[model samples]
Target: MNQKQSISYVISSQSSSQQKNYRTKLTAVLNCTRLLLMQELSSRGHDESKESLNKENLIELLNWYVARRKKINEVLFSNAPRNDQMTSPSIHKDLVHCCAVETTRSMINEMGDSLFSILVNESRDNSIKEQMTVVLRFVDKSGHVKERLLGIFHIADTCAQSLKDAIDAMFPTHGLSIFGLRGQGYDEVSNMSGYHSEILERLNIEELSGRTGQF
Candidate 1:
């Protein structure tokens, strides 16, 4: 029988007073754990018996599961070099960073005396990692609208200063200066772009004061 059918048969026959060897009983426990690890699936059939199974079928299913899992683990770890096993993501990121830095640098080189609009946004991709996407939008020297991702940086926190620092680190490398910044735009995020966002306040205030020779 296939894995699914064998599993169902084992569950259904659990309450039967059939003869069960030690292996069958252990397989029942492991199978129940695997099913219930689904949370929703495990919550069902709680009142059902869990100890009886056909000894041979239970052993067969257990072996099938083990063999399949072993092959997967082997494929994932066996051919991968030690450094690549853990650092693949970092290497990909380094390559992307190089490409983005080059792209933004070239765009700036063509920008000349033209001013541009900067768009800022944040996204939470993983449970723990918050990333900021920086983009530049403008009509270039050729008079065509152009937009490009400058970079995506990890922001340790969503607070205003953390956001500012992330972009600050990228600006000089890409030939951007606040004095040449024409406009800044971001959504209504409380700390960075909201009605009273601190970064917005800092940048807007600078724009206003420069005209009056003030802060």
Candidate 2:
């Protein structure tokens, strides 16, 4: 059987308590290593600790500390006022935006002076809002090709010009310039294909040779 099948079979054969015990033991091993590293750092005067440095004692302390913190957090969250909690819709949206910004920054850093092409498409979201999705394709410093979704932008319409304007507006926020584009791709639809020449003329993207095709 395959590795996944083997793992599934093993998990299915084990009782719930057995699985729990196995996970607890695995966690303890990791915690034990962390505690040992902390003790080593303390010995080097990089940190200070008053707890016993014995292996078993350190493992027990870490297990207790983790369990206590988990319990405390659960209790606090259960009792805290809903408005004071961090699980609000706005908070989640902010967190997601932050993650997207950081991820895009990292991707750009990886691309680092390399020419990149963009793939663009327009579609209606579940809410029937017209949105344009942009993706970047490039070779990294190590010569591996990478493709990353740049962003999805809400547009006023699905016309070629509207889609092109939306993409243009997004570039400045990400510190990108139209001159850096080496190629462009769009869905082979009537709305996009019919205006290919117009888009090429308006954007002055000479690299695309007045045509749009898949990357």
lDDT of 1 by residue, 39-121 (tens): 43312222322353432332334434546664323323333345433213354345444545565678787776666667889
Instruction: Flag regions of model 2 displaced more than 4 Å.
Output: 1-68, 71-75, 78-83, 193-197, 206-215
lDDT (CA) per prediction: 0.58, 0.64
Model 2 residue pairs with clashes = none
For model 2, residues 1-215, the per-residue Cα lDDT tens digits are: 47656967867888986555445543443444445444653212222233545534433454355577653343233433444333333553454456567778988888778878888888899999998888999998888999998888999998768866787788788888766677777778756654554665556564565343333
Q: Which number leads on TM-score?
A: 2
